[model samples]
Target chain A: MHRRLALATAATLCGALALTACGSSGSGSDAAGPAAGPVKLTFWSWTPNMDKVAAIWNAAHPDIQVSVQKQASGDDLVTKTITAAKAGNAPDLLQAEYQALPTLVSNDVLADIAKQTAGTKDRFAAGVWQQVTLGSDAVYAVPEDTAPLALYYRQDLFQQYGLKVPTTWAEFADAARQLKQKDPAKALTTFSANDSGLFAGLAQQAGAKWWTSSGETWKVGIDDAAGKKVADFWGGLVKEGAIDNQPMYTPAWSKALNDGSQIAWVSAVWAPGVFTSSAPDTKGKWAIAPLPQWNAGESVTGSWGGSTTGVTTGAAKAGHADAAAQFATWLNTDPEAVAALVKEAGIYPAATAAQSGGALAAAPEFFANQPDFYTQAAAIAKNTAPAAWGPNVNVAYSTFKDAFGKAAQEKGDFSAALTAMQQATVADLKKNGFKTEG
Target chain B: MSTTLTDRRRTAPAPGTTPGDAVAPPRRTAWIPTLVLLLGAVYCLIPILWVVMASTKSSGELFTTFTFAPGSGLLDNLAELSHYRDGVYWQWMANSALYAGAGALLSAALSGVTGYALAKYRFRGRTAIFNILLAGVLMPPITLAVPQYLLMAQAGLADSYWSVLLPSIVSPYGIYLARIYAAAAIPDEVVEAARVDGAKEFRLFRSVALPMMVPGLVTVFLFQFVAIWNNFLLPYIMLGDDHKFPVTVGLYSLLQQGANAPALYTLVITGALLSVIPLILLFVGLQRFWRIDLLSGAVKS
Candidate 1:
């Protein structure tokens, strides 16, 4: 028994030492991604169908070769890009979601694409263009796709209740109550407490520029007056039980959408595809509209989910910055590439030219022959207010999600969640060695 | 045996208790343990069952139909999965098989050799060495993966099979288990006699001690086998080439894209359903060789 105890104790120490003594033998070698003959550039992306776009570029330029490797996971890709950037051996190009643009920019992982390429920033929508830009001409990523906020509602239910589409936020509140009064079991919409992206977009629509940078100092204003106004409007509706309180895109929300208890969903452009694919039964009854706003005369919008491809700092180290930039621009702006992304990936194209005359603008059959979805989304993409996501958006989102969930249960003020978000963001910025003014 | 023991003790005080008491309704409380074990098995099998039924669904039938009700698109899903990027799913499965199968085999052998030496030989710092290995078992895989990848990168082994395979082959837990198991299973007298009879140390270990440690070594191999097979962080960090990815990473990337487009979810479900077959088959094929109780008796003797 003493021998067994000694052996057990010995094994535990051995396990700890094994970890300390082991070394990664491959640190000597450089994963520079450099090539001898054709200028080979490694493109890391989690985006499906990026290979087809790379193949097109590879087929076009014999002197320049592009190889696309799908990262094992999106989170892995981000982690790898940061690690490689620190090690000075980053990939030539990589995919970054629009929300993570600030994270990448703050890490100095991205090469300034605006300076790399002469012009063509104007080709993409302004709101999307905001994500990749720090200051004028300091754009680090090119816009690839955008998910503009669009209202999708049960048209049959709306018509049954004698409700017309609300053109503004005031009208939307009235309809939410009117529709609920017509049928006590029904709600006009639902909200997701956990979905910070949707809330970010709504805050954007309310003209809250959440992040601001000025010569190494930054300020976060997630709970600004405009944002609070919008939140209070929704919070009042929440207290009145006009809207169903449920997380969007969940199984429960899907069930609610199908059953007509929740008649409308204000979501990203991707929701139409999700609705069609997830609930084929709700095919013809759904329709799309631009998101309602506080101002009756104004038509402002917001963007939720989107992605961009950027040249990495290591591209310069490998002497392929030009090639990488060329590929990124072509992948986003080239008609064939944009068409393929739309058709294969169901991505709502961010390029103005692609959405204008390309096949993407054609009415989708899933929307019951709604011709205005692509056009309306493209228009919203242009009008979307420029809002910046901080490097600590993940932390801020969590802070807000927790507070927001609590607020919901207690019937408390929703804007206070954003105040918690602001405090967390400010503290995180200070911890990360950034000068915080607010 | 435990139930019967308790049953015998409980009824021993009853006067005129006959032999029939032993055979009649063995123990009323036997059903409790049986029911508990059956519940545990069902809990484990529920996901397997759900995936089995889910694999049979079409894209349209996925969320609309009752979740567990099997659909008719099983063959179609298989065909589609096979046709995806020229059946890359099979390559992932084959890669997982290679990583897990070969990693376990190599780890088990190394563990056996090291375990035998640590158990049989009286060397300095043996306890210290064993303790360190036990501590390694406590280290999280995620904590080690980045450093392992960086080292693999330094050696120019990143994105290669060696990076994943080499790190996996040296499982401290496996080695520790083998040491404990070998000490219990192989008697010291046997090794001493083998040495006295003019056998080399290597010859004695290979021919005598190895055969005696078969049951324990199988356990070591299987422990490493499942550990390496289901590991996501290691390969997810080390390897970049999707062609080199195991089924877990492949299905993960597929599932990520599937989150946006629910149509690809069927492919993910089907791939998952098919990936578990090899491990199940492995367990069944190796069941006959298990004689782990030999160590318990050998230790007492």
Candidate 2:
């Protein structure tokens, strides 16, 4: 029995060591084998939309196979990429978010795809090109989609409440107030109290940039006059009960969106896809309108969120790096493919040439026959303020979100919250070694 | 002597026997304990229930209808999740099994040997070694994971399975439990008898003392199994290849996509449901060996 138990223990330990050895040896062998294939490109994307990309690639290029490793959201993608890079086994292609561009660039994990694609900017929208560009020259990402916020409302509810589609923010606020009075149980608009999404949208309309630069210094204008004005207006609207302050992932939020408890949603061009996907039962009840602006002839168009693709610095092969860049560019700028993504995946094309295709021209009747949806979004995209989004954007956003949560739930002072966030934001940026201008 | 040992194990007084009276108080809280257990079970099962129900629905039916209402897309969602990247989900599951199964086995064995030494022998640095091992338990995994990654990178082993399994095999809590179990269960007399019968120390430990430690080692195995199975950070930090991901990381990446493309929610839910199978099977199969008495003192009968 003693001999048997000792042998079992040794055997188990040896087995563990052997497994580790086998794993190491296998990875070593995989290193020498055709890293590309049989031409298998390891593509990591953090969206279900990646399914569409995979399908498109599979349908066309059987020989040049693209294997997509799905990751959830940009947050997950960022975490996974960092982990993979640390591990010395990063995927060749990474689907990165536009806001996270600075972090990826500063971390030096991304390859400069600009050198690979000479003069590829001509095919992409102006805003898309501007967003993908860092400091004045280096391009870190190839733009995949552009989303300009639009008002998605229930036309049936609008007619019931005697509300015409308000083209301006003031008129929209007025209409919202009347609707709130008409039914005390519901609000005219619903805004996530903690989210800077609406504020970002408003700032874009006012042509305010989040960050500005003068060759060497980076200045954050988040608490600037235009932003403050926009913040105060929204703060006033919240006090008036024109909107419902709700959390994003709550059951109540989902219910409100579906049952007409909330009548309108201000979202991006890609958001319609989410809506159809989220609440399919409310199919014919929705219509799309160009986002209501604070002023007529002014563009209130701003990016709520967008994603791009980049090659990791830890890529196994240099040739694979070129392939990744090629794939990213093709996915972003290919006219036929971009249209397919827009038409099928509902990703609004960031590529200028793709936006003119039949896919963008054909409006889904489910969205209340909004024929000029892409055109309006294009106009918004053109006027979007070119801000130098810093690496601290996510950290600042989370800090402000917490303060927003406190104010909304705990009924704390909004001004105090904003002031605290401003201070914390400056401290965070300074700590990260980013030269910040007060 | 055997009867005396059994008597010592029974702490509960017989029913109808009190200090001076003819009747005794009940040892267990009958209805109250049962009620509390039921409530605990319900609380643990709610999120699991939601995942199971949600996995059955199409993305369209996910948030549009009642949350708990079952839909008809379980097989469809599974099919899609399976076909995602030529069935990478199964690869993650296999990797998780490798990490948890092999990790737990090695962990239990190491704990047994180290624990037997600490319990049976009086050594110069035993207390210090035990204390150092215990201190490892208090250190947050995140604090270690970052440095571990950096260290692995230096060794050029960061992305491999060794990065995950090596760190897991050295579980401090497993060693601590093994020590306590060894001290209580393995008798010095039994070791002496085996030595007198001409067995060496290692043979004595294997033949006589090991059987006594079986119940405790089983507990260590289960504990490490669950720890490795549910581990997200170590694998999340150490591996970049989606093929090498554990189910937790796989499900997390799937959910991230669902955030932008809500249609993937079905896949995330279905994938989460699929990930829990091995763990459930492990717990059920080895449950008899999970003697709660080992936590207090190893049962010797």
Candidate 3:
């Protein structure tokens, strides 16, 4: 028994030592050897048909072959990418949302590609370009697509209600009220607290820079004057019961849009794509207009969803940074690539030159009634307000969902929810060891 | 012999109740417990029913139709799912089967050996090892996904089939179950008799202990198979290639195709409805083993 105990103890110690050695040896050793023959790169993206678009490039560029690995999009993808990077197993290229750039950059998942992507800045709009640069000299990504905000309303419904298309927030409110008086059961639109991106875009159109960094300090302005104005305006509408306070993207919301219970949507360029499936019964009945302005005569709009193709730090360590950056640039700017992206992936190219012609020259099938749909979208896209993002946008966005979701359900003060969002965002930034300013 | 004893015990009435009372019919059925059970069944089945009903609807009709109403797009949805990315959905289905099927078989084999040794042996540090495994059973596998991914990365196995299979093969709960089942089902005297007969240890276990532990091992296999089949986070984090994704991750990728495209709700619902068929078939096929009591033909008291 004694001898067996000694043997067991020795075996246990050896097993424990082996485990610890395995754990410790994982650190360091990120150096890559010299490449040979053709360079193969993997790209992670959530865009549908991205592989088809990449296949176009792969056929042209035989030396630097790129493959697209599709991923589920959203905030979860950001966390997944960061985790993969920490393991030094990140893909060569990643398609990231414009807002998630700061988080990825701060995590060191993305590499600075300004040197490789030089002379491509003129390809995108100024505001769209600013997002990829993050107000820095280093460009972490190339802008692939932009979703400039617009108002999509039912032309027949508006005409029936004798309501004019709102060009300003005041007129929009009046129209909502007028529609409510005409039919109490029907709502003109809804205030959806479920989508933080929608609220952020609305606030951006009001000129609220929710996140801005200078030197080494970050500032969170989620409850600033412009933010409060936008919040209060929507709050007043929801309080008065002029519009619905329900969430979007729900089955009920889809039913409403399909059956014309809710007649208008303050959405972005991608609304047509959503309507194609969600409100298929209402095909060709919707028309696009610029998002109602905060003040009259202002032509500014905000983007809801857009993404950039960024080269990962792992790609750089793997000696494929230049090849990845070249693909990223060509994926967004090259006329052939962008057109294929538009045709196959159904993206609104951020490149100004490509946004108007080629694949987008004809309106989307769902918007066949509106012949100049892309023209109107392009005009709105030109005036997109610049957006600022911090490393903790995910935190702020979740808080927005919780705080504002409650406030909207209760028809309570949204300004208070906005304050909670700001406080939570700042606290998170500080907790993450970021220097924060009010 | 033990089955007869259990049968007699089940038929025997309560000790406090007289024979006349046992023969008497109940005044009324237990409506409250019956109602509660009905509610529970509905609660568990509503989501599954919703998936079934929703899968039949076309994309346009999915949200517009009534909740339980069936539509006419089941065949279309199936075709779309089959043709998606040139039948990548089937690839994901095959990958799920490989991960769950092979992972469960290996886990059951490993658990059988470890559990038999722990239960039947009198070796030093046996209690310590068993206790460690108990602690492991308490630890959720989701929390260890990132650590496992990192370790797999170090071994140059991160995106490979082995990365997922390796971690899944060492299920603590499976071993724990097998140990308890082994101790109760296999009597000490049987092993002593086999020893006096000069049967080797491996021969004794293979011929005697393994046969007795079949029911418990089947339970473990089913549990591990279902756990691996429904696993999302492990494979989601470990594998970067979509072709290697299970149906859960593949359906998610289809649903969340960025803000540019509408979610493929119909395809996802159809995929979900199809994915559960294998699990149901597996349960229906293996359920007979669970009906066999562990000590059915063992020594009488």
Candidate 4:
């Protein structure tokens, strides 16, 4: 029995070691195989309901087959994509968030789409298109979806408090005060203590660019006058107790939204779905309007989260950039594809054609049948100034979130936090081997 | 003897009952200890109960409804989960079973051999080897995992099942348990007698020591099984193919999607609930060995 046990144990160890040897050898053979086996291309994306987009694309193009692998969202997706690209195992086409483009560009993992594909520049909303371009001429990705900021207010709360929808920052602050006075338990909405992206969006609307390039040298001004100006506006409101300070995406925040403890939310185009989904009973109790202006008559708007489809340098090595680039552009801007993203995935499309006429253009039931709410969103997407997120935006954004909270609590003393963030960003850029200009 | 220990279990001192907190045996009623055990069990079970009730809620109803209230969406949730990615949840379930079942079995057998050898033999560097093996437990899993990924990538095994399965086989904690159990369970006299009867070293161990060690080794197997079954970070860092992922990583990916599209929350909740059922069943099923061993000193070395 002991002899038999010894032999079995020895055999198992040998088998395992042999299996390891086989696995190590097998990984290299797949990448070197011929490109003729049905031209199967793997596409990675986090956007839900992309099976519809793949199905539509597959039916038209029989020679090139595409498979969409949904990944985790945001920074996680960026980490996975860059690592896989470094490993030479990345997908042919990948969906990147608009903010990740600068990092992806610096990592040298993206293909220049304009150089690879045909005329596709006129397909997207202008501001959305600007987000994917490097410097001026190098287009790195096709804009898939955009988030133009807007105000979603509770109509019932507005009526109960006898307040008009505030159009300008001054009027909005005044309305905020009046509403807070009416109910000490209520505020206009919660200022997210954790979202620096929102502050960046506000700064973008105020014409502050966090990163820009002059010739070859990158310039970073994280705490510039524009950022401070925008920060001071929101900081003063927060300090005055006009807005509640609550973390977004928490159970408490959802409870506040559901129970009408909060009266409004300044959100991008995609946030309405979350509000309606989380608080379905509030259907027809809410209404949409343009973002309250920074200046009384000015119409500038900021954006939050959006994504783009980009061809990677890994795909370039496979010698299928033309086909991949065509698929990338078509996935975002094509009428049927954009419709799939909008209707099935609940994504706000970046394509002007899809945005112009759609089921979305009709009055939404959640917003009390507001006609032309989406039209206002589409209008905001055009001619709005785009911010240049630096290559280190991911790190900078997280650090900025911490500093923004401190600044908001400092009673309009935002300049200190802005300066802190600027110095920190400059230090990080220099550490990462970038020549930075103040 | 086993019955006496079980009957004395009320006075066996509860998990957190320290030496200083001990009460005289004659001072406390049996009810006090029973209540304390029941409290511990309930504390462990409430989250599971909440998950069961929460999985039945629709996305909107999740926030609005009382947490413990069972909603009407159970069948809807099950149907949606089955249809999601063509029932990829089942694939994750199967992958988890493959990793845990196969991994624990191999680990238990190897632990049995090395643990018996360490306990019964006094070879050179035996203490050094044993101590080195024990030190592996001190290394954080992430520190091990990152280096494992880089090494696996270089080996061209980064995304393979073997990448997860191979690393899982070496459980230092399991081996430690096995060593202690072997020493306590097997008698030196039995081994000497087996050798006098002309039994080979392997035969002596196989016929005498292994059977006596089954219940204790079962504890080792269960530990490794649970450890591998719920492992998240290693597979998350290693595997690219969702098809190869264990349920934890799979559910994590699902939850990540839930962050952007909140409607996916119901599926994530349902998936989390379903994932727990197998582990609960496993714990309940394999707990008999622990009960048997703890009831009596089943074997002695």
Give me the candidate number with maximum TM-score: 3
List, residue by residue over B211-253, the lDDT tens digit for candidate 3: 9989889988988999999999999998999999988899999
Model 2, stretches more than 4 Å misplaced?
A1-42, A49-67, A79-90, A315-323, A339-346, A364-382, A410-416, B1-42, B48-61, B64-88, B121-124, B298-301
Candidate 4 regions with alpha-carbon error over 4 angstroms = A1-23, A26-32, A359-365, A405-415, B1-26, B29-46, B121-125, B200-202, B258-260, B291-301
Q: A1-438, model 3: which lDDT tens digit per residue?
A: 466445444433332232234223343434344467788899999999999989888999999999889999999999999988988889999999999999999999999999999999988899988998999999999999999999999999999999899999999999999999999999999999999999999999999999999999999999999999999999999999999999999999999999999999999999988999999999999999999997899999998999999999989988789999999999999999999999998999999999896899999999999989999999999999999999999999999999999999999999999999999999999988999886
The local lDDT score (0 to 100) that residue A223 gets in candidate 1 is 79
Fnat scores for every prediction: 0.43, 0.37, 0.58, 0.30
**Which ranges of candidate 3 are over 4 A from the true structure?**
A1-34, B1-28, B291-301
TM-score, structure 2 vs. true: 0.86
Docking class of 2: acceptable
DockQ of 3: 0.44
Consecutive 10-residue window with the lowest summed lDDT within model 2 chain A: A21-30
Model 1 regions lying over 4 Å from their true place = A1-27, A31-35, A72-76, A409-411, B1-29, B258-263, B291-301
Chain A TM-scores of each predicted structure, in the order given, are 0.91, 0.86, 0.94, 0.92
lDDT of 2 by residue, A40-73 (tens): 6777776555656666866777655677766556
Give the Å shift of residue A195 in candidate 4: 2.2
Model 4: docking quality category: acceptable
How accurately is candidate 4 docked according to DockQ? Answer: 0.33
List lDDT for all candidates, in order: 0.77, 0.71, 0.89, 0.77
Computed on C-alphas against the true complex, the DockQ of each candidate is 0.35, 0.28, 0.44, 0.33
**How many residue pairs of model 2 clash at the backbone?**
14
Choose the strongest candidate by DockQ: 3
Model 3: residue A77 alpha-carbon error in angstroms: 1.0
Better of 3 and 4 by lDDT: 3
TM-score of each: 0.90, 0.86, 0.93, 0.89
